[model samples]
Target chain A: MKLTILGCYSATPRTLNNTTSQVLEINNHMFLIDCGEGTQVQLRKHKIKFNRIKHIFISHLHGDHFFGLVGLISTFRLLTREADLHIYGPKGIKEVVTLQMKLADSWTNYKLIFHELTSENSELIFEDDLVEVHTIPLNHRVYTNGFLFKEKEGDRKLDINAVEAANINIAYYTKLKQGFNVKNNDGVLIDNKKVTTPANKPKSYAFCSDTMYKEDIVPIIKNVDVLYHESTFLEKHAHLGPKTKHSTAKEAAKIARLANTGTLLLGHYSTRYDGLKAFKEEAQEVFNNVELSEDGKTFEFN
Target chain B: MKLTILGCYSATPRTLNNTTSQVLEINNHMFLIDCGEGTQVQLRKHKIKFNRIKHIFISHLHGDHFFGLVGLISTFRLLTREADLHIYGPKGIKEVVTLQMKLADSWTNYKLIFHELTSENSELIFEDDLVEVHTIPLNHRVYTNGFLFKEKEGDRKLDINAVEAANINIAYYTKLKQGFNVKNNDGVLIDNKKVTTPANKPKSYAFCSDTMYKEDIVPIIKNVDVLYHESTFLEKHAHLGPKTKHSTAKEAAKIARLANTGTLLLGHYSTRYDGLKAFKEEAQEVFNNVELSEDGKTFEFN
Candidate 1:
């Protein structure tokens, strides 16, 4: 799995800083998250194929989170894209996007599927054969939801020499990989585990942003391979976190520690801070593994 | 009058190329024209003060023309702006913008006044003491209007020597400047023209974009000091101009020549061309004075 950070700044977009937007590539699917203003330009700058994005997940209705959505959809139409696009966001997203299209009288030729979320509980939002996505309800000034992407377990690996020694037929190889017992060339039943090993552990990634320090979310995101939590402020500005419903670096670290994620990625920094080193330093004090997210940076997980 | 081209390229915004958006500074007022996506970032890059922009003029409801408007307004709210902002655009502009605000649940603290236009003919839309703005109807695939910004004639120049020699009262100077005959201290009525000359011929500027070669607009924008017309295609791609409802460089120059504009500024170039020299060459063939607009370029009209 590879994740690219298109933008990571909080509040308004500046010349050098952009608002929240990221591209997560998992299980051969590219998912766009939180398309802030200027996101399409950032995508172009990053050289990400526009057509690779088939699903878009928005955290909230805030301008900084989803303002670039309509522009991107319009651009797709201008490019004459034929692929179906799915958008998962807050309840009001469909109305806002369709209204803009209606006003401009420029409707997209492709199918635009909107999955408006109103559920306050953790529920499965999207699922396929290889991966499944669930919503992590977040506490913010408005109705917001973070997404959790998890790869499903794959087929078991075949012990070729052991299978050959067992006189397993080529046709039975498929059944062995599926962890099922099959008859060998001698018409005798053979145990699947004797010739096949279990599949590699599935990897998971959780993305949470624009939320206050909520301890209840730890169980929902427990033991994920990677956890990206918003660190909009430093420890010095801890007082403003609750007031603004944002999380400080220390608060994000606490959540990361409780969730026991393999890697804790920090992002959505407030532009008021001069450098990002302080956030990493503050987060490291609590969590053993911490990484800072910068615009245009990419992270890979195996 | 000063005009700054933030982004002048046609169609979707790319890495180095931007969509249509510019800033026109006339008579001490900073008027923003056609805020395409990423305009707020462009404004910040150009170091233009955000609060100085009290008025925004949108040519049409196309995504490239006004996609950045909602984000800019939301940024104003985040900045705690209290000034009134006036937007003049097509009739459906209000519905589109207001619906986005409703979805985000983020309303601006400042007053947002909308002036919807539905007229197919040229009409006056905005007027102040120093400047007046009118709509210049153009032919396009959508209901589009170009903007005509003209500086209102100022008070006649004060000839201090002539006024003192005529024994005119200082209080009557206001009346003389207003082209009214004023009585002097000797009780003799003085002719206004004898003491004051006409205000330096009111400078005018016309901006037309995303329109085909339409000759009817010549009368409305005739004799303007500077005319910025859309040149979305060059002569080589002239066949695409009529089909796309866009003007070519040669076609733009034809309109400029017919209108007798002092300087024809060509912009909104299609990204297919590698360089703008071809556009200037083609335009100068028809009109003597033609200037190509580039992103971040500024033009000062004196």
Candidate 2:
């Protein structure tokens, strides 16, 4: 899986720093997360293909989180996009987006499907043969949710030399990959594990932003390959985190440490701070593995 | 008068080119016109003082014209702006803007005044001692209007030497500036023209965009010092102009010629062409004094 950070700064979008937006490419799916203002321009600047995005996930109704949504929809209409677009967001997202379309009188030619999410518990939002997505309820000033994307376990891999030595027919290969015992060409029962080996371990990623310090979320994102958490403040301004319902660098690292994530990625920095060095240093004090997310940066997990 | 072109492209914003938005500074007032997406960032890139803008004029409800308005408003609230902001646009603008604010649960601490216009005739919408603004109704796919900004006549410049030679009292300077005949210290009636000359001719500017080749608006914007009109296509693609409710460069210059404008400014070029050379050459064919409006270019009129 590869993740590209289109924007990572918090609050206002500046010339050098952008707001929250990321593109996650996993299992042939490109998912857009938390499109802030100027996200479309950032996407163009980064040379991301607009048509590849089929699903968009929004965290909340904050202006900094989803203000670019209407513009992107309209641009899609202008470009005459024919594919269906799915949007997953808070309950009020549909009303806000549809109202703008109604006023402009420029309805999209393509199908626009809205999945309004209102559940406060962790539940499966999307699932397919290869991947599953679940919602992680977050504590913020508004109704918000973080998404957890996990790759499903794959079928076992066949050892060709071992299968041939066992006189297993090609027709039984499918059954063997499914971990089932089957009769070989010699009419003898064969064990599934003797001819096949288990597939590689699946990888998972969790994205959380604009939330306060909540210890209950550690279980939902436990043992993920990568975890991206918002750290809107550093230790110097840690006092301002609770009032704004935002988390500090130390708080995000504490959650990552409890969850045992392989890598902890920090983002959504407030513009008041001059540099991002303090955040990484502060987060490293709590978690052993830490990474800082910047605009136009990319991370790959194998 | 100074006009800064923040963005002047026709449709969707690109990596380098932007959509429609401009800043007009006349007689100490900063007016924002047609805020497209990414306008807030453009404003920051240009280093414009955000607090100086008190009024915003939107041409219509098209996404390319006004999609960035809600984001700018939210930014103002984030900056804790206490000044009143006045917005003038179509009848449905209030509902569209307020709905987004309601969903986000973010209201401005400053007063937001909306002047919803539904008139089809040219009418005076704003007036003060220094400047007067009028609407020039234009023909388009949607209800639209072009703005006309005219600087009001200023106080007459006193010929200081001539006033002293005429023996006019200093107490009567205000009357003399108002073009009134005042008695001198010797109680002699003095002629107004002998002591003071007329103020510099009041300058005017008209902005017309996203309209077809309609000649009816020529009378409303006639004799303006500067005229900025949309030229979305060239003569090669003039056939597509009427269907899209856009105009060609040659067609815009024809209106400038008929209206006797001082300088015809061409903008809102479609992204199909590479350079702006064709637009300027085509517009210059019909009008002697023509200027091309480019992004980040400023035009000053004295």
Candidate 3:
């Protein structure tokens, strides 16, 4: 899995920095998260294929989180994209986007499906044969949700030499891969473990942003391979976190420590801070594995 | 008068190219016209002061023209701007903008005044002591209007040496500057022309964009100091101009010639073209003074 940080700043977009937006590639799916203003330009700058974005997930209705959505949709129409696009966001997202399109008198030739989310509890939102996505209800000033993408466990790998030694027929090979004991041609029952080995462990990623320090989410995102949490403030400005319903670096680190995530990625930084080193330092004091997210940066997980 | 091109491309913004937007500075007011997406970042990249932009004029409801408006307004609120902001656009602009703010529950602390335009005829929209703005209704797929910014004629410049030589009383200086004959200290009627000369000729700039080859606006923007007209295509694709409600470089130059504009500035070029030199060459064929507008390019009119 590969994740690209299209933008990581908060509130406003600057010349050198952008607001909240990211692209995650998992199991052949490119999911766009929180498309802030100027996200299309950032995608182009990062050389990401625009047509590859099939699903878009918006955390909330903030301008910094989803202002770029309508423009990106119009661009898709301009490019004559025929692929059906799915958008998962707050309940008001559909009205906001369709109104703009109605005013412009420009409608997409392709199917534009909207999955409006209004639930206050964690629930499964999307699932396929290879992956599953669930909503992680977050505490914020507005109705917001973080997403957790997890890869489903795969079928067992077949050992060709062991299968041949066991005299397993081609029809029984499928059963062996499914970890089922099957009868061979000689009417002898063969154990599936002798002919096949277990597949590699699946990986999971959780994205959380624009939220306050809520301990409830820690249980939901526990033991994820990677966790991207918003750290909009430092320890000095920790008081503003609760007031704004945002998280400080230390608070995000505490959540990371509680969840026991493999990696804690910090992003959505407030522009008031001069550098990102302080956030990493503060997060590292509590969580040993921490990384900082910047615009145009990419991270890969095996 | 100075006009800065914040974005010049049409349809969509690219990694290096931007969409339709410009900053026209006349007298002491800085007028922002057609705020496309990424305009705030472009404003910062060009080092334009945000507070100086008190008024924003959107050409139409198209995404390329006004998608960045909400984000810009939100940024102003985030910056805690106290100045009142005036937005002039189509009739549906207020509803579109206010709905987003209402959904996000992020209303601006500063006053946000909307001047929605529904008229198809040319009309005066803004006026001050030194500058006056009028709308030049253009023919397009949607209701659209181009803006004409004219510097009001200033007070006559008093020839200090000539006034001193005439022994004119300081009290009568204001009357002389107002081009009125006033009595001197010796009770002699002094001619105003003898003490003061006429002020520099008023400079005007007309912005026309996203329109077809319509000549109705020629009378409204006639003989302006500078004229920025959209040239979305070249002569080879001239047939597509009218169909798309756009204009070719030759058509823009023809309008420039017919209106007798001082300098013809061509912008809003389609991304299909390779370079801007072809547009300049094509426009120069019909008009003597023609220049292509590029992102970050600025034009100063004397």
**Interface RMSD values for the candidates, listed in order?**
1.0, 1.1, 0.6
For candidate 1, what is the DockQ?
A: 0.81
Model 3 segments more than 4 A misplaced: none
Model 1 C-alpha lDDT per residue in residues B175-292, reported as the tens digit of each score:
8888899899999999888888887888899999879999999999999999999999988899998898999999999999999999999999988889999999999999999998
Question: Under CAPRI classification, how is model 2 graded?
Answer: medium
Provide per-model DockQ scores: 0.81, 0.79, 0.93
Q: Which candidate ranks first by DockQ, i.e. highest?
A: 3
**Model 1 per-residue lDDT at B46:** 97
Top model by TM-score, which number?
3
Model 3 accuracy (lDDT, Cα): 0.93
* Candidates ranked, most accurate by TM-score first: 3, 2, 1
lDDT values for all models: 0.93, 0.92, 0.93
Residue runs of model 1 more than 4 Å from their true location after superposition: A186-190, B165-167, B181-197
Error of 3 at A241 (Å): 0.7
TM-scores across all candidates? 0.96, 0.98, 0.99
- Tell me how candidate 1 scores on lDDT: 0.93
Residue B80, model 2: Cα distance from true site in angstroms: 0.5
Compared with the true structure, what per-residue lDDT tens digits does model 3 show for residues A68-179?
Answer: 9999999999999999999999998999999999999999998999999999998898899988999999989899999999999888999999888888789877778778
